[model samples]
Target: LVVLLVRLHLTGFFWGDCSLSNTLFRRSAGEFAAYLVDAETGELHGVLSYGQRAYDLDLLSTNVFGELLDLQAGELLDADVDPATLVARIGERYDDLWRALTDVEEFSVDEMWRIEQRIERLNRLGFDVDELDIVTDWDGATVRIQPKVVEAEHHARRLQGLTGLDVEESQARRLLNDLDAFAAAHGLQAEDPMIIAHRWVTDVYEPLRAMIPDPLRGIVEPAEMYHDILVHRWFLSERAGDEVDFFDAARSYVESILPARAATVSAAETSGPDELSAVSPSDDDPSFD
Candidate 1:
């Protein structure tokens, strides 16, 4: 979340009225992919001053805390989660990340360690430094360095190259790990990558995707289905006291887990002006926000 805020701030987006309801989350390798859904009050500047960035983060933290409190009241949030502490942590982490990205450090020419350290830190945080702006003293004995441009999505590109699959960063990492496992199990590790990828698409990815019924296809993307099945496989294996075969695991997932989700994606596509809202259950109140 610290990385998300800093990266968005770097790219000139100021989400003026940030809130939990304005974001959509997708499961990703035990984490989540958070997409900004409602930008109604957002503004884009060429650059933001520290004060402006702080203001945005403050709004986000406050709104998120309130949302957490509401969920806790409804018994939806974990009992141990504290809203105030969570919000405070966000502010503290945001400050640290902001400093890392924008602070300037002066180091002597002999201290090349400083140069590599900055790049390594950003890369570890899933950012790529495209270029550096370095200024040396008149005698070239000291230097100041700054990352000119930092971009995210390192894993996404690697997965795309290997399998032509476009997925979120965390999902891509999960899938790539699976692909490697498949190659090793089948003795395809030394074979040409394209051939290995083709077999994976045919023997692994495609079969998993094809298992979804046509009526349920829109509920989740192919890559997401694959990831979920992988997770489902683990639980199924755990219960059986041994590893579950991929197809059996996938069948169990579809039978037990996919039904409740069928309406979700289709509902999102439907809420457009031309579409009618579904009838609400009689016991449910309609006026609540």
Candidate 2:
């Protein structure tokens, strides 16, 4: 909800009565994605003033607070959830997010590093700046810069460029992190990313999936399985007080964990790339099993 509101505000959208009750959520990759249900009261502007965003955030906070109260009354709220403190941070965090996305940043001519820093932060938040505008005063002592055209899929596109993996944005980010670790561990940092990516997919990812027993093949998406293995590796490493390699973690996860997990793919699925084809007996044998 916070991210949706923040992005909307960044694009000069004033969602006039946003609320928890107005959201529809779906399990996206590994996170819940929310959609705005009621847009009849919304307004779009070329640009929203500070007071406008602040007013919208205030309304959002109130709606969230009211919803939390209802949830608490019905015993649907978590024990650790505090409605008051959570609502209080809404405005402050939105302001910070708004600034990070659309705010114009100025730096002295010598401090060119700030430009890359700003871009890195935006990329980390899953934004791609298609156009950047830089202006310098007559004195030429400093530069004023702003991201003009921003879009999502910053990490997804990069991963696609290297590995041709079309995955959800969060999944791409997780996979890229693992790919970097794999490259560094294998002393392939100096090699081309495409070359290293091919090796990583063939040597690391495919092999991991191949290790899954036929019964558990439909438990989860292959990329999601690899993502969990990376997470599981971290947990196993922490408990053992040493870094656990992928092989050790994957072996333990398959034997001790994967079989116990409920399959995400429905049993109704009839055909998939991994399913075996029916074998027909040759003319030499009339019987076919």
Candidate 3:
């Protein structure tokens, strides 16, 4: 909720009636992402003043506090939930994120590497520093820098550009790491990035996606399933004292992990070992590593 509010404020949007009921949450990788659902009272401007942002935060606190209290009275609230603490923390989280995005930092002229460090920090936070404002003191002894224009989904955009996979930021980050490993493992690190990404998509990603049974498709998202399979592969590899084959790992995941989810698969159409083995790539497919 705080992240959604921060991004909306960044784009000069004022959500007048911010509340939990006005937002929707979805699983992004392992983390939850918030989206504004009812923007009926929202307004757009060239820029929002401090007072406008403050007003939105106030409304959030008020509406959420009342809602939580109502739930508590009805015995519907979680036992660990404290309406007061959660409401107070919302503003605190918002301020921390806003400052991290827009605050200016001053440093000695010799510490120019801080600029790259700052960009890396923002990227790690799933934001891109599109434009930065850097100023030097009159004496040239110190420099100040702030991000002027920032955007979110830094890793998602990069992953999409490379492989055309539109996924959540954290999932993209995980997939990109696997992509890098794919390139390195196959000795394609020196090849063109687009070409390498294409190879990874065809040999690594798409094959696993095709192996997912129709009945199991909706148990989790495709990208997240791929990530979980990678994690499962690591554990399987460790247990066997050797690297587990990717296809075998994926089959194991579909048969073992997916059934534990709420969805059930029909026995006749499930991707059993023989079905997956039939669709598995050839040994020479070049994604083995």
Candidate 4:
């Protein structure tokens, strides 16, 4: 909610009536990304002044507080939830994130590395610092820096460029890590980035994707399923005190984690590309049986 509001405010949009009821959420990787549902009370200006932003935030707090109180009165809210505390926390988080995204920083001339560090921090927060404003003191002993323009979806763009996968930001980050691991595992670190990405897609990503049986395909997204398999592999590897083969790990995932629909995938159906087929699921494997 705060992220959506901040982005709107950055773009000079004032949501006059902001509340839970006015927003819709969609899954972004494993996290929720907020979107405006009803903008009837919103106003777009050349640039919102400080007072405009403050009024919008205040209105949000007021609406949310009243709604929360109504929920509490109707016995719809959790007993432990404190409406006032939640409202205050929302404001606090908004302020903190707003500062991080827009506030200027002053540092000694010798600490120029802080500029790149700031951009890196923003990138990690899923934002791309598109423009920056930097000023130096008359004596040039100190510098002031602030981001002028910023946008989100940092990791998503990079992943899409590398592998043409249009996924949520967090999911893209997860998949990128896997892709890096794939490159390192195959000694392809020095290869052309595009070639490595294509190889990863063909040899690693697609092969694993093909193992997902048709019956279970609707249960989870491909990227999310892959992420879960990576997590499953980690746990299996930890339990076995060594790296588990990917196919074996995936077999365990299908049988133990997925629903009854997974039982239809036979050992032969789980067989993947040539690289993964070496450790193919056997007919007597518990998952297939």
Candidate 5:
């Protein structure tokens, strides 16, 4: 959690309202990565002061604690989980992440490898720095550096670049990794990414989309359904050590998975004004004969 918060700060973002719901967790190369959502209310500060950073941290902790309590009330939390201990640990995690992203060191001018090293750290944290904000003394004897405009959640963009499929941030990351694997298997190059993605959509995505039953079409968006199918395919592939054919996978998904998803949209059409009040009773009184 600390690692994620510090990363966001380093990227010049202040998650104005942070909480577990705004974040999604996914496994990447055996470690969990956090993706921040609900950034509509967030602020982008040119530079974050220590006090400002601490306040953001405090809000994170408070929000997380409150969320956990709410979960417990709903009987969603594990009985063994301790709220106080968990909240404290979250703070500790934030501090550690902060240090990794910002701790500076002095190096001789002869050693220029530090610059590369800094970029590598951010890359490992799933970020690509578009521009670095660096400061040098009047003599140019020493360098001070920070990332000026870092692009966060790169996986989402890459996935869309390849597949033209927009997805939720975390799911996009998962799908992008799969696309890379698919590219490698087909001996595809960076220049040929779109071609490969098209092949994937034709050979994989479309078949799954076609399998959606007409009655249950409103369960989720098609792109999201496609994303989930890819996830399901990955798990199945890992279990069996064989690639599952897209159509077969789609059949299984539509049968077993799609049915379980509750449709949020109602089938009944709403009555328009013309339909609701189409006819009115006459107010004329009948004369007695």
Candidate 6:
């Protein structure tokens, strides 16, 4: 919590409300990351005062307590757990998060590669630092820097750039990694990542998608389907002691795995796609019986 608060402060924003429930977790390059979601009440400030920061922490504790109580009521929390202690622990976690996001490093001017290193650090934390606010003093001897316009969900944009597919942040990160691996394994190199992503989709993703029978098509989203297919391929390769052909793995996935999942319902509570047509009047039928 402290870490996020520090980063937000460094970036010139005040999170008026901060709590566990207001954040979502995603895995970035094998590390867990927290993203702020309830920013509707947050304030953008040039700097946060000590009192303001404390108030945010207080709100966070209160919110955590309430969430724990609610979960207990719902029978989701362990009976032995103490909410007060848990709330305190949450603060520690936030502090660590804040440090990771805003900690600075000193590098000699000769080590210009540190700038790229910093960007890579932020990307692994699931952020894109759109602007780096760097200042060179009058002496032109010292450099001070902070990231401005830092935005969350970095992988989502990268996935869109590559595949024109927008997925949950974590899923996009996973898919992007797989795409890179696919490119390397095929000895393909091009500046356009999207071209490679397109080839993978058309050659690999779409064929697997088409294998789904119409009756079971709505069980999962296309991106999720593709993710599962990749997992299946890995397992198949491991079992056979050789790389499984993509098409063969896809066929096995569609036949064996996808059928057992529950059918995905439409947003309006309709039975299925055919449900609409079944209820509609036929063109030749008279309105009056």
The candidate that wins on lDDT is: 3
lDDT tens digits, residue span 1-289, model 6? 4445556766667787887778876433323457788899899887777677678878878987998898888776778998989888866876665655666655556666777888898899778888886666677666666665677678989888777876767678888887888788877776477778888878766776688788766656666666667777787888899999878887887776655432322322556445544544344422100
After aligning candidate 5 to the native by TM-score, how far in Å is the CA of 13 from where it should be? 6.4
Clash number for each model: 0, 0, 0, 0, 2, 6
Query: Candidate 4: RMSD over Cα atoms?
Result: 9.3
- Segments in model 4 whose C-alpha atoms lie over 4 Å from true places: 65-84, 215-219, 238-242, 260-289
Task: Encode model 1's per-residue lDDT on 1-289: one tens digit a residue.
Answer: 5566677799998878777788878766657777888889888999988788889898989899999999888876778899998889998998887777767778999997989999888766666778888999999999999887878776677678877888888888788788889999999999998888889888989888888998877667778777777887887788789999989988877876665445544655677422323422122321110
What TM-score does model 5 achieve against the real structure? 0.66
Tell me the spans in candidate 3 whose CA falls farther than 4 Å from its real position.
68-78, 216-220, 234-243, 259-289
**What TM-score would you give candidate 4 relative to the actual structure?**
0.78
Scanning candidate 1 in windows of ten residues, the lowest lDDT window is: 280-289
TM-score of each: 0.76, 0.77, 0.81, 0.78, 0.66, 0.68
Among all windows of 10 consecutive residues in model 4, the one with the lowest summed lDDT is 259-268
174 Cα displacement, candidate 4 (Å): 1.6
Which residue pairs of candidate 3 clash? none
lDDT of 6: 0.70
Global lDDT of each candidate = 0.78, 0.78, 0.85, 0.82, 0.68, 0.70
Q: Model 1: how far is 79 from its true place, Å?
A: 2.6
Question: In model 5, what are the clashing residue pairs, if there are any?
Answer: 2-93, 2-94
Q: Which lDDT tens digits does candidate 4 get at residues 79-157?
A: 9999999999888988988899999999999999999999999998889999999999999999999999999889999
Which 10-residue window of candidate 3 scores lowest in summed lDDT?
260-269
Off by over 4 Å in 2: 12-14, 24-52, 210-219, 259-289
lDDT of 3 by residue, 1-289 (tens): 8888999999999999998889987656556678999988899998999999999999999999999999899876878999999999998998989999999999999999999999999999889999999999999999999999999999999999999999988789999999999999999999999999999999989998898788767666789778778877887888899999989999987876665432322332476644554544455422222
lDDT of 5 by residue, 140-224 (tens): 7787777656665566677778788766556666566666777787777664777988987777667666777777665555766
